[model samples]
Target: MSTSSFALRLMDVHVSLAGHEVLHGIDLSLTAGRWSSIVGPNGAGKSTLLKAMAGLLPVTGSIFLFDQTLMAMDRKQRAQQLSWLGQNESASDDLRVWDVVMLGRMPHQDWLAAPSAKDHAVVETALQATGAWDWRERSLGQLSGGECQRVLLARAMAVQAQVMLMDEPLANLDPPHQVDWLEQVRCLTSQNTTVVSVLHEVGMALHADDLVVMQAGRVVHQGPCADAVTHRAVEAVFGKRIAIHALDGQWVAVPKF
Candidate 1:
């Protein structure tokens, strides 16, 4: 298939942090309108991979967004195509939830452009989608970690980007919120948005449309999420402490003992 057909494509991608290599020579092509999960142990470069894909980390590889080379696109153009939720994102504590959500509209606006009716509608819809509508008037400092995370997710959704890249998005979420998070991802895919996320929850990651198993700075496997071969790859990448099982028509990884 042509590279342009892939929603997000990478060629020989490499990333380093604090003078140490985190990702090495990774090549991946995420299909359009699919939900993909990046799973790995601590320091395995799952987050690094996502950051590289979002153009957050300076890396030494070719990244293409549909038919355009990522680096060639201007900042505004790239921001319009890719929306990102970074790990442990923190905003101004003084801003209200609604104000924070409005930040997502910046990419679509000119300098000093005021929020339009369309922007307000999009923000409202995103807040409802993330269950943060009720907290729209609340100050960011007053919210619990989970609530703030939801608000941030709503902001990302408000960007209305074709590709969403999230790093450890479920970090502050509860069990119910985690389930809702997965459903939000599915909903994005259904709307033809592509998503890639770094997740610590193996079981949740297994539910994605495709899986990328990373280990020691390399992509050990990438394929259909339900394939037995991919299951084996997950087991191998994570070691025997994790076991893969089918539950409710979805694959999950759990402890063996």
Candidate 2:
């Protein structure tokens, strides 16, 4: 296979937590500028896989980012190229939303340095992109669950990184807001930003360019999002309890019963 198009490649990657293995050896390659969605049942290690890719978890195998080993890159350099939005990210509730979003620029700033004009502009764009601009001056504690999720998304977007990893980004979002977030991700990918997301919503995962289906800590399926074989694998992993269907040109996973 031609590796030239891949941004990240994993070779025999394995991860363990609390002395119990979560991810079995996972070998995969993710293409640059493409959107990938990972789906699996509960405790299927979907989140673990994303964390490993983000270099947030301890793994024994090699993960090469943009042709460079993740281990070889310094922490700061890694931050310059990758951004992560974890599930239920904690924030200082008393902090203003703008200040919270500005935290994303820390990697680009010098010690004790003030926010630059560029930093402010980037934060503004990020906030607007996530529809969080109106709450810029509000306290984080004042926002609802869904609003907080958008603000956290804004912080991730402000990183200006080439690659982004997100876990359950739509957790607190309503249907309409979820659609908006999808559009935001589409726009980012158009700008050549690689996005890898872990989603429990199978229908939402279908919107990605590619799909990775996991079961028991291993990827059982990976291919074009609309591929029939991939859809079959998705059903098989769930013991055929959910049926994949096509409705109005969209794929949806509905319960078999």
Candidate 3:
């Protein structure tokens, strides 16, 4: 396939933090309109890679988003094109849920301008999609962890970006919500929005269209979820402490014991 076929492409990407190299020279190309998960042991640079792709970390080398140079894009353009949901996001409990979600529309708003009718409409849609519309008037502090996560997800959805990067998005959610999260990802990809997430939940990560297994700051494998090589890659990363198995038409990694 042509290089342009990929939605996000990296060439020799590198990152260092506090005088320690977190990512060795890494290269990856993720197909557009698909959900891909990055999975690895802790400190394997999975989150670092996700942050690099989100432009939050200063890195060397090239990152292309939809064939456009990522760093060259203007701030407003970048905001409109890419949305990021960081790990363990925190918000003021005093704020109303509706207002929190409305924050996502800030990117599309003009300087110091109030929200337009379209902004309200988009926020409403996002809230509904995340199942947080019913609690729109409630304070964030009043909601449980799972409920709060839904509101946060609605906020991210309000950005309406073509590419969404999520770091451990399943945080604070229960199993049902985790399934809902997977469904939401599928829905986004169906709408031709690219999604790349860093997840610690191996079973959940397997639900993605593709898997990017990282080990020691490098991509050890990249392929379809059902690919045998991908399964092996997952096992290898965990040092065979876990095994990937096909179960009920899905891929999951289980404890070897």
lDDT of each: 0.91, 0.93, 0.92
Candidate 2 lDDT (Cα, whole model)?
A: 0.93
After superposition, which runs of candidate 3 have C-alpha atoms over 4 Å from their true positions?
none
Q: Is candidate 1 or candidate 2 better by TM-score?
A: 2
Per-residue lDDT over 1-257 for candidate 2, one digit per residue giving the tens place of the 0 to 100 score? 57768888999999999999999999999999999999989999999999999999989989999989998899888998899999989798999999999999988998899999999999999999999999999999999999999999999999999999999999999999999999999999999999999998988999999999999999988999889999999999888999888999989889887
Provide the lowest-lDDT 10-residue window in model 2: 1-10
Give candidate 1's TM-score. Answer: 0.97
Residue by residue across 1-257, what tens digits does model 1's lDDT show? 87666999889998888999888899999998999999888888888788888888899989999978898899999999999999999899999999999999899988998999999999999999999999999999999999999999999999999999999899889999999998999999999999999988888888899999999999999988889998999888777788899888777788976
lDDT of 3 by residue, 1-257 (tens): 98777889999999999989889889999999999999999889999999999888999999999899899999899999999899989799999999999999989999999999999999999999888999999999999988998999999989999999999999999998898898899999999999999999999999999999999899888999888889988998899999988888877788987
Winning model by lDDT: 2
Which is superior by lDDT, 1 or 3?
A: 3
What stretches of model 1 exceed 4 Å from their correct place? none
- Each candidate: RMSD: 1.0, 0.9, 0.9
Global fold similarity of model 2 (TM-score): 0.98
Model 1, position 51, has a per-residue lDDT of 80
Which sections of candidate 2 miss by over 4 Å? none
